[model samples]
Target chain A: MKPQGIKVLQLMSSRINKYLIISLQIGFLFGFYLVGGYLQKTLALPVPGSVVGMLILLIGLYLKWIPIQWISQGASALLNHLPLLFVPVTVGIMQHLDFFSGKSLWLVPIVLVSTWIVMGATGLLGQFLANRKEWDR
Target chain B: MMLLQMFFWLFITLLLYVVFRRLYQLLPYPFMIPVLTCTVVLVVVLTSFDVSYDTYFSGGQWIDALLGPAIVALAFPLYKQRKLLNKFKVEIFATVVTASLLGILSGYWLAVVSGYNEMIVSTIISKNVTTPVAMEVASMTGGQPAFAVIFVMIAGIGGAVTGPWLFQLLGISNFLGIGMAFGGASHAIGTAKALEYGEREAAISSIGLSLCALCVSLLGPLLLKWIS
Candidate 1:
């Protein structure tokens, strides 16, 4: 009933609200994953369930069905920790060390050169188009 | 009981990852990427202790499970930048398509010319996109998803490492171009690096990454079929 007691009650309520929003965001994400998995299994789509889940979330946001504030906090938290999730797969690369042997020696060079080509081509092409409008103006 | 042991060991791995990640940030070397460093450390520790990848993955798979949620979360950032998407919609689409096509052709032809198997060629074809999409494309095209992951990581990490410098060397100073190049070529890791430049670069990078994935998913199968 006192001022301190009221303040404590407000803080607890706000904390609970924060946790509630996070749970809802995660629930939505998991729901999409389930839908994607179902589609993949039943339809035999080539797309991965995760990619389908991503599209579902994107459509939710675009259609205004999902509030930004509802998902932003949990979403950003997941994105911030994204690299950590990939560590297992990256480490899993160690399991296939033999794939790099013999003729596969070209694999590294091919990946490196293609990356450079893509970067250069995209940069140059984008810059040219971006500047073309300016020059025309 | 076995599950408990797996959880305990994975917890240790995660703890070591955090410590090493912080340590890598404090170091000055560009090659000292946190993920790569943490991976090397975990692999060494596991190998030293004779822990098989399967045992480690028993618990590690829990962390990997979050990847789907993390990807879905990307929609938030993409949503925030919707205005930018509208502004540069045509240019973004154009650049991504061109770059993705270039990447696929270069990767595929080189692999073929090098006399690698069809599987290797297919894996290399999807290296320009993020891991999940890349793996899917690889599998759809009859390649090994594990091999695709390796190729994707190499492309992503290599692009993140050298992207800015390469752009500068090529005399391209436009942030749009740099961001697009990073996203189209390197995927998520490159986009993460691009975020350091500013919000605009990050937004454009996300666009590039997504468009790259879309193009690969749609065109990759057709291209492989035509080539065969």
Candidate 2:
């Protein structure tokens, strides 16, 4: 076979395998999500099912019930493309234009100030704690 | 033609996001974050073209469905950071709890002071937590999920943009401090930005957000009821 033919074959085969692995990883993550949703329904937990699923996954990985390699690829693919998923929801802001106007004009400044306040206050406190001589690791 | 048009919006979203993402990578500008840019452009295009939100979402919902699984995937990074988490457990845990409480209380106070209605107050109250948890918080606290999302976005984006600068101004140089700050205040979106800073920061951020979500969910309703 020609060198070009061999190169093409290798590319296709590798790409195909990568896709398969990624799909499997996504399946594993979906399983966790299902369990989480089930638990949420039964327990009436305040936290969302997806979050609960995440905690379960963390514990699974920690206790070695789940192998990191099984989910790593899928997890990263989802995480890296995470922002893309939120695009639709973020665009939902169009429906609520009324919130930015009339009596709600204050929403802008309030959001801005409170945002700064949270980050600034936590940031300052985090620094103070990090610098403490006692907790030094 | 109808089928093509149905898929057209989805195609446009993917194309725009890829283009903007590539551009952000090359330039690395903070405000030009792909999510922000893509949403802004999509909204402008949809509004100017007189296309309704429902039409765009006909295709957009496919992407939206993935948000749940992505939430589960958050465990990956948190697991990776198990060592550091174990070491500084006290500090990280304390800071995020404080962040959740402060963020809710401050936002609540501002809305009350502004004389906004009960709905607005509820929506803004859970703005600190990630979207999933924030939505639940919004509903429980008598806010609209839609409005709560906007506040969450604002908080996340604001924290990502100002976080580093604020840390610098406040003299917090450690990655742990910075990551905690981002995750504590902004949750998922902030953690996403922290990824650009460093791996350690992103890892810490991942856990920071998860814990923050839990804290806000458990405490948001109780706190809101007490205050109001």
lDDT of 2 by residue, B1-228 (tens): 656766998899999989998998898767878888898999999989988999999889878877778889978877887787787778888888888888888998999988888998888878888887889888888899887887888888777767767777777777777788888888877887877787778877878787888888888889888978
What's the C-alpha lDDT at position B174 in model 1? 80
- List the lowest-lDDT window of 10 residues for candidate 1 chain B: B28-37
After aligning candidate 2 to the native by TM-score, how far in Å is the CA of A37 from where it should be?
1.9
The local distance difference test score of each candidate is: 0.82, 0.83
Root-mean-square deviation per candidate? 3.0, 1.9
Q: Which candidate comes out best when scored by lDDT?
A: 2
TM-score of chain B of each: 0.88, 0.91
Cα lDDT of model 1 by residue, B29-147, tens digit: 55676667778788888888887888888888888877777666767777888887787788898999998899899999988888888888888999999887888898888998888
Stretches off by above 4 angstroms in model 1 are A1-24, A40-46, A133-137
lDDT (Cα, tens digit) per residue for candidate 1, span A11-91: 999999887888778777777777876786788765567666777778888999987877888787667666677788778
* Model 1: how far residue B142 lies from native, Å: 3.8
Question: Each prediction's DockQ?
Answer: 0.63, 0.73
Chain A superposition TM-score, candidate 1:
0.74
